[model samples]
Target: MNPFSYHKPTTINEAINLANLTSRFIAGGTNLVDLMKENVVRPKRLIDISGLPLQAIEATANGGLRIGALVSNSELAWHPLIEQGYPLLSQAILAGASAQLRNMATTGGNLLQRTRCQYFYDTGTPCNKREPGSGCPARTGLNRMHAILGASAACVATHPSDMCVALAALEAVIHVQGPRDERQIAFADFHRLPGDAPERDNHLSDDELVVAIELPPPDFAAHCSYLKVRDRASYAFALVSVAAGLKIKGGIIEDARLALGGVAHKPWREATAEQVLKGHAPSEALFTQAARVLLQGARPLSHNGFKVPLAQRAIVRALSEAAFGNTYAGATP
Candidate 1:
């Protein structure tokens, strides 16, 4: 790891003031610490925002939930409000890292976690995300974990956050605080696709800090599911995960929200596909059609073509689980 100065700020303003282009905030040190060790990210300064006051899970006045950035993943998953009102979020969080890592990973840190592409981590290799204009080896190398959607010629990396997939389906809003002022970013617009700029992940500025996450009123609490498929059963990143939310009435779908992970640069959500689910009765045929619509424009890589079909089936299964009132499922092959 690079030798860098460390600062512990007790206040949000202090943390914000300490932020700079060459500095990074460390709340849980779950992901950032690993990146530093791998030499994937070498910051000149480490700002310890763990001491800052940003750890709370409260209900908003508008009947939504406001989650402080520093709220631990385990805490958020098991929080009574989250478990009762947004079980999909809880499920997604639990499906992530191991129990110990979850205890250390924070909401903001999870949001800022880097991709798991091997080429991106191995400093000896060439990865566009690691160094722009440096050739993307994953595009033609062993790339079973690479992207199948929203990929570009410059990069084929996928976002590696299960919580983010659920957040996308929940339509959560990201709250950020920069040196200038605070702003709200819609979840759909927060994470960007890998177009020309593969280095940038989300819309967060260099000097901005994610203070909290805001969730709109819960609508699909009663019918929701988070399904993650991976090579191994435990402690593995997703291959093709789906977060499905459905609101059905009189055996007819009234509303639907579906977001995909492990298949794109961001949490992939096609509003048109979700619209296809509305007003239709939940069935195998309907779900299959919706999955087809969701994977319409998917362009798989050399070794990750399986992800396209896997994602489609996962979406159908996730929606069926949600509509049928099932909760969790195994990561079966």
Candidate 2:
């Protein structure tokens, strides 16, 4: 790792004053530290924000929950309010990493986590995301884990956060504070697509710091599920995951929210698919149709054609579980 100066800031103002283009804010150091070791990111200064007053999980004025940026994944997942009101978020966080990592990973850090694309990680390889204009080897190289949605010629990487997928489905809001002002960004708009400039991951400005995540009311708590399929049963990144939240009444879907992970540059919100399921009765056929609608625009790479079908099945199973309140017995690859 490269030599860098470190600063521990107790106040957000102190942290903001210390942040710059060459400075990075560290929370749990789960992702940033790994990238630094890989030489993918080398900051001149590390601003430790863990001591800042951003470690609370409290109720919002609108009967929702506001999770501080520093709240650990394990804490957020097991908190009574989260477990009772937003089980999908809890399940998604638990599906990610291991117990030890979750104990250290923070909510904001998870949202800002970089893609796990092999090309981006290997400094020896040419990757547009790692060094813009160098070219993306994964575009035509080994790309089983590459993206199928919202990808460009410059990059085919997929976002790797299972928690963000659930947040997308829940329609959460992201609060950010910058050197100039504070702003609230819709969760869907927080992460950006890998367009020409694949180097940039999200809409966060260079000087902005995540403050908190504000979740809307827990309407789908009773009928929400997060299903992650991976190479292994545990402690693995998702090959394809589905976060499904449905409000079913008298055998008909009243409202629905669906988001996909491991297939896109950001959390792939299936708004059209949700519309297709809103007024329909839950069935395998209906679920299949919704899945098809969700993956209609998918353009899979050579090795990752399997992700399309895998994501489709996972989506169906997740929706089935959410709508009927029964576990699906199918196996995942």
Candidate 3:
């Protein structure tokens, strides 16, 4: 580990001031510490923003929620207000990390967590995301976890957060404080594409402090859910996960939204699929048809053809369960 200085600031202004001086933003110390240990991220100073008054979950006048960045994953998952109003988010959070991690991981850190790319973690490899213009090793190397949608030859990493997938489906807003002032970013546009610059992750500037995450009220999030498929059942990232929210009226989908994880560079939303299901009766046939449309442009790698079918089936199964109340049958082949 490298020698580093730590600073705990009590105010947002001071936090941003300290944040601008270094690349470190410490909240729960769960993700950053791990990366720092691996030498993936080395900063001269670590700014501890946990001391600030950023841990509040208050209902907005708009009847939505303003979740403080410092709020632990456990606190958000078990909050009575969140459970009663946004069960999907609660369920997603519970399925993530572990009991101890959920206790220490905070809202800001979770969204900003780095990708699980093996090459990115290894300092010996040439990953453009780890070092600019170094080139992407996963581009031709063992790339089963590489992305399909919104991916460039430069980078193909999939974002790795189930809760953020749900947030993307729900159209949550990200709030941040920079050296200048505060700003709110829409969920869809928060994480940038690797068009050319794979190094820069989110829309966040280098000197910004993520103050909070605001979810625009989901009147029906109580009826939503997140489903993850991994090689293992526990403590593994998603092979293909679907975070879905739907409202059925008279056994037909009235309003539907779906975001997919482990399939694309970003939290891939099945908008074409949702279009197929909306105003239609809840049924397996309809789900499969929409799933087909969503997976139309999937370009799978040699060893990852399974993900194409796996991601497609995940959509079908999640839609059926969320809309028609059906369980997923495992891949037959």
Task: Give me the candidate number with maximum lDDT.
Answer: 1
In order, candidate lDDTs are 0.92, 0.91, 0.82
List, residue by residue over 1-333, the lDDT tens digit for candidate 3. Answer: 899998888788887777654558898998899899999989999988888898999998888999999999999999998888887788778777888999999999998998888999999999989898989878778888778777887888888887888788888999988887899999998987788898888888878978889877666653466788887666777778888788888777888888888877788875777798789887778878887887788877655678888877787777767765543322222
User: What is the alpha-carbon lDDT of model 1 when measured against the actual structure?
Assistant: 0.92
Q: Roughly what TM-score does model 3 have, to 2 decimal places? A: 0.95
Best by TM-score: 1
- Model 1: how far residue 232 lies from native, Å: 1.0
- How high is each candidate's TM-score? 0.99, 0.98, 0.95
Q: What is the C-alpha RMSD of each candidate to the true structure, in Å?
A: 0.8, 1.3, 2.2
- Per-residue alpha-carbon lDDT of candidate 2 for residues 152-270, written as tens digits (9 for 90 to 100): 99999999998999999999999999988889999999998988999999999888999999999899988888998888877888889899999888889999999999899999986
Q: Write the per-residue lDDT of candidate 1 for residues 136-178, one digit (tens) a residue.
A: 9988889899898889999999999999999999999999999
- The predicted structure with the larger TM-score, 2 or 3, is 2
Candidate 3 weakest lDDT stretch, 10 residues = 324-333
Total backbone clashes of candidate 3, pairs 3 or more residues apart or in separate chains: 0
Colliding residue pairs in candidate 1: none
